[model samples]
Target: MTIRISRRRLLTTAAATSIGVLAMPYLSRAADRPQITHGVQSGDVGADGGVVWARADRPSHMMVEVATTESFSHAKVLPPIAALPESDFTAKMLLENLPAGQETFYRVRFRDLAHPAISSEPAIGRFRTAPADRRDVSFVWGGDVAGQGWGINPDDGGMVTFATMRRHRPDFLLHSGDTIYADGVIAAEVKLADGKVWKNVTIPEKAKVAETLDEFRAAHKYNFLDDNVRAFNAEVPIFVQWDDHEVTNNWSASKQLPAAYKERSIGLLAARSARAFHEMYPMRESLAEPGRIYRTLHYGPHLDVFMLDERSYRGANGENQQTAYGPESYFLGPDQLAWLKRGLLNSRATWKVIASDMPLSIIVYDDAANRSGSEAFAQGDGPPRGRELEIADILRFIKSAGIVNTVWLTADVHYAAAHYYNPDKAQFQDFEPFWEFVAGPLHAGTFGPNQLDNTFGPEVKFIKAPGQGQQNLPPSAGMQFFGHVRIEGATGQMTVTLRDRADVALWSTTLDPRPGKPG
Candidate 1:
């Protein structure tokens, strides 16, 4: 039950040293040795296994060693895997047969392919495996990093919200989409609304919109340049999903080529972005459906997170007002919706958390300037139309199957709020009452308190956003937010709290699990 981390490997040193730098190869003590660039990360952890990821500066072999102690006494060395040019020098390997409910420490180093004797300095990472039995569980959820031209600003503390979240020391982070803003360019400096200068640490790859495969890869890598993000990744595992920004803003099958993009084919850009997304994160691969983002992660007896991908399969974005189940109504798509229902029915956990990338009732515009076209599920406030049909179906299915304790957590609209969906007040009232919590803009522009649609009758309980006539406010405005959730083992009650970058709780509510639901 005792776990510890070395002083040098912990967060303080990482925070003080690695700010806004790419951990480039040439900066290494020995230029010929392969460097462990971008540090290390762990993800998709469960009772028995997890995925370990790291990137190297050159073609090398990634070697990993696992241990239960900080001193690495009796550490077990795993087989080495090759990191080649095909994957952009990034590699991840599944670590199996880990003990449940215990802290696991792993060390990663890259050995030069040309000279096996030469190896880079080891990067350390730690994560606690999911409990085999009922126990207290806690985690953080948020997303939207480096979005809306807000890149790493070292002068402004280099994405300090990540450091704030890391202080909580959650078991993992449920990153609800917008992992990177591939379409958003990052300049060296930006002029804020207050006439103050916001300095950014920019690279050539992030200077323009991502078009080529390498550009997409670089976009993902750009986030790691922030020391806070890298330190957070080393300590906590991440369960990640992608939304529109991973490819482009409001991207769909019918997206028009923008003036900034030289590569006209949206399909090609999407393909490259998907490849880079899979390469960058430490998510488990789906053999059945390769590059699939939607999957279930069983954290323990108390929690099961259902990660959804709302971007990959969908119709074109427009005025989403379809009245029936069709291409335009496909939000989760048919396959993913079925998988979610099946997973919910099969789950035995106390809390069934639907980790959606987009909120249900918040009206996100595909064309924000014109304020027309639906980017999310809510198409005005009337009935369950367009993409809302798919969500309504899922909600109805959850109710009919008597699945209790179902909650939705999302982070796409760049703000934080709480909504209570009541069937009695709804236009479509088949679903049972539930709670949907929203939080985000982990380190991006803060813009909402968006208009809510009453299709499923969502009543806003609380909201925090920019003032009227204000939008895309910088993180320096102190509006950045994230959600923290904890489930008590003995009581089976889940508490959700919305907090800002300063780690101050803005609002919170505790929900008791439904009766007769197995804990």
Candidate 2:
């Protein structure tokens, strides 16, 4: 693979080559070398490029080498990026001008700045670039990891669902939010309903809810402690977004902090958590809005994924029955909603997948005990109201623009289900017919098959969740689920399959593309 190195990178490489002779002796001394704390990862891959991430134990310059072959004999050495204390010793670089429709292997090593002669052992990673043509596309997506006290259980095989998803060998993973349960506390041991004990491999930062920046950063690091997670990260590129749990449970601008949190200001916690989230993952930095999570990921001509940021722009969790489109009804907020509409109208892919962190039409109650206020984009089974208005506007826009073959994929409900939005049977029926498939709880407690709020007429096609008396079931209950998608290059048909922890295909359906020109 030919890489066009920047002038800065070329200079850095030349300097490294010169230092190699003097560094040879120190390299043999393992004790003096810097340490790679976590495994390497790659993400936000496109036709030509992607981002690669790694962390070091101390202040160091992260050196990267890219090659098409695993042997890496003719690897192109990129510029060394610093892994400093400011970013918690983590560093990531965007690798560009790579060949499309090919496997790219990368190796990451940390050269200690303190001891310029010494370097850490390399961590290897790989990712397949998006094809420029209509090649077959496959990806797995799910969310809510290490949540509700269900953390890495050594006895239970340590986040084995990741291992299950890894076996599929998808092109990438669209992590549908709740990447970390920052609001959920992890206990070492807890008695189960079956008269057994569920044990977690815990750390100090995970013992309580994440508040400080270090604590939030540690929450992301805690997931890497699992063998399955680290092994999965090494191979699969992840496109991640955040949700409520990444900050606090159902958090909004007006969130009321619980007694457990000594920090009374929710704003401060959100700020710290946002920084940690960006630093921990391999997400491509947005130039327009640096901290923005809503963006479009075009994966060849087959699929274009629009990942949304519902939490960051939302107003507050309250009675979501507002009739007017105001602050109380703001879900995706004005800017993100406008962006989604524009993106959908401009997308030329056969399938436009809206990768939402939260499921629409699902009645997620912020006050579950009373079932009063809404948490998601639904406000019971009525005409478009509250947050549903924003979604309704998008749907109406899609129909008016004649955009075809749009599908919604989401998690956040802690269950797996397929819903077909039939406009004909709806109270509000301006939108076109579409499908929303939900799958999740990668390694968290199993909850519901939530009640559907038919604002736009969502018909339940298939659902798999805990029974009436089985809410918050343990991961060992075999209900942990995820979703897989594969689009055929020849037919442009999209097949979505929901699977369990054991990699069993619980349910699946294939949708053929509508005969229409791409918008």
Best by TM-score: 2
For residues 137-201, what per-residue lDDT tens digits would candidate 1 score against the true structure?
99999989999999999889999999999999999999999999999999988998789999999
Cα lDDT tens digits for candidate 2, 1-519: 112345354334554563453245556668778999879888899887788899999999888887789997556677678889999999988887677787999888898888887888889999999999888999999999999999989999999899999999999999999999998889999899979999899899988889899999999999998999999999999999999999999888878898999999999999999999999988888879988888898899999999999998897888877888998889899999999988988888899999999998899988788877778998888898889999889999999989999999999989999999999888889989999999989999899977887789889989999989899988999899999999999899999999999999999999999966633
The parts of candidate 1 lying over 4 Å away from their true place are 1-29, 517-519
- Pairs in clash, predicted candidate 2: none
Score candidate 2 by TM-score against the native.
0.96
lDDT values, one for every candidate: 0.88, 0.88
Total backbone collisions, model 2: 0
